[model samples]
Target: MTEQVMAAIDGSQFSEGVCDYAAWASRALDAPLTFLHVVDNHPQTAEADLSGNIGLGSREHLLEELAHLDEQRAKVAQEQGRLMLKAASERAVEAGVVEPRTRQRNGTLVETLSELEDETRLVVLGKRGETAHQDSGHLGSNLERVVRSLHRPILMVPATFKRPEKVMIAFDGSKTTRRGVEMLAKSPLFDGIPVHVMIVGAETGDNRSQLDWALTTLHEAGHVAEGEIRAGEVEETLRAYKEQHGIDLVVMGAYGHSRIRHLLVGSTTTAVLRKADMPVLLLR
Candidate 1:
């Protein structure tokens, strides 16, 4: 089956940005675009009988009414999802996605994406989804799960969109980041765009060697690439470098460390996503 750039959108402020970035990625990869909307079936009040010490007849009547209300809510949610997908499709067409596709599923977002992961070359999502308060700065409830569950690269974009010009990859000589460099070398998604490889930590021999290896790999691939080893906190250094260089996109490894390590020291991927104002393409 042909691979596609799958974009998961919802009725949120970030939906427009998701469409914009999805369209850009589809064109960059020369692949088809798909807009997916999932009407999540959250646990409903009908499942709980909260009427305590009520008459049997009254309790039954309340339960029936609750069930009816749940059905009505489901119908409204389905309709809303359909309209969202239609708008996203039209937006994609306007943004130059040729004959974009849309799918509305009745399930949880993570489960739906996992089922369609095989056909997805890339996944585009909002930094914070509709379930999260936009001002709360919390990562989308499903973002971490999707990233961990799927094997494809996931692009998590902010509430706004901007065509990426320069991209920076946060490197730390890990096996995952090495594979990321190799993937970037072969992928045309960032072709003709400048790539900067940044290593944040003590500037040591290993770090220099890793940085050199990355640069050489990109150079061999005919990419305009440069690398540097900086000394500072990982997240802070990455943010400063991105700001100073005006990088529009940040590419990095997601949850590459061991579970114990992540538990001991929080995951850099999560930290970056929380504070990032630009798009982040995470390679797992």
Candidate 2:
């Protein structure tokens, strides 16, 4: 019944990275690691609906063939998922995780994770899922939903795993973000890693105070932390700071704005997820 670091592996290009990062987090948190692979049920559901509408004769034969085809596809996908889970667990073992576990289920990724959320300490996923386009700017279709649904911290890793040496916090002084800073201050995930906290937009007194508070909080927790204020868009400023400092990971709070509002005006969280080349740890 111990809490575990649950990693979502979908046999995408990011699967390896997900395993690596999840392994790192498991070791850092001293928690058990579990790799989860969910085979989507959309195809089977659609095929079943179509099969019922077929009348008779040739159509009935077609329905039977289609049902058989769907069955075959589902079996193939399940076998593939099993293989992928085995590979992921092996990779985690190689990455210094001890006795990593894996689970394969028939459902959506979001639903599976939600069911296991109580036992999960952290969730790690690739920036893009298997169905996502190859374009670097494309966000995974399920990323936002997963983030919205899970209360636990989610680490969205890039296509490659790089041992993070420097970390950046996109601070905005909101309650959620403050909680994120608190988590970083107390969590051992970034124990020896130096952190740079940056604030975007005007350098007002309140912003400076908040930045100071963040630095103080981190410093109190023994982090080698520093703060800065920049003038520009949040995403751009954070990206620029990351590049300038060679940050391998970016940590921040996300989804503060309503979903509809974010859709209309766009969101810094979405923008960063779309553009970041490094791993991003999101706190909801």
Tens digits of lDDT, candidate 2, 1-284: 99999999986899999999999999999999999999896832353356556676568788778778878888999999999999998888888899999888898998999999999999999988888788999988788789878899999998788999999888888787899899889998999999899888688999989999999999999999987999987788888888888989998877543345464123888888898888989887
The TM-score leader among the candidates is 1
List, residue by residue over 124-230, the lDDT tens digit for candidate 1.
99987776766646776678778767888999998788988998999887888899999889888998989999988787888888899999999999999987888
Number of the top lDDT candidate? 2
RMSD score of candidate 2 (Å): 2.6
TM-score of 1: 0.94
Q: How close is every model to the real structure, measured as TM-score?
A: 0.94, 0.93
- RMSD vs true structure, all candidates: 2.2, 2.6
Candidate 2: Cα lDDT at 75: 93
Model 1 misplacement above 4 A: 43-49, 257-266
Where does candidate 1 have its weakest 10-residue lDDT segment? 257-266
Q: What C-alpha lDDT does candidate 2 achieve relative to the native structure?
A: 0.87
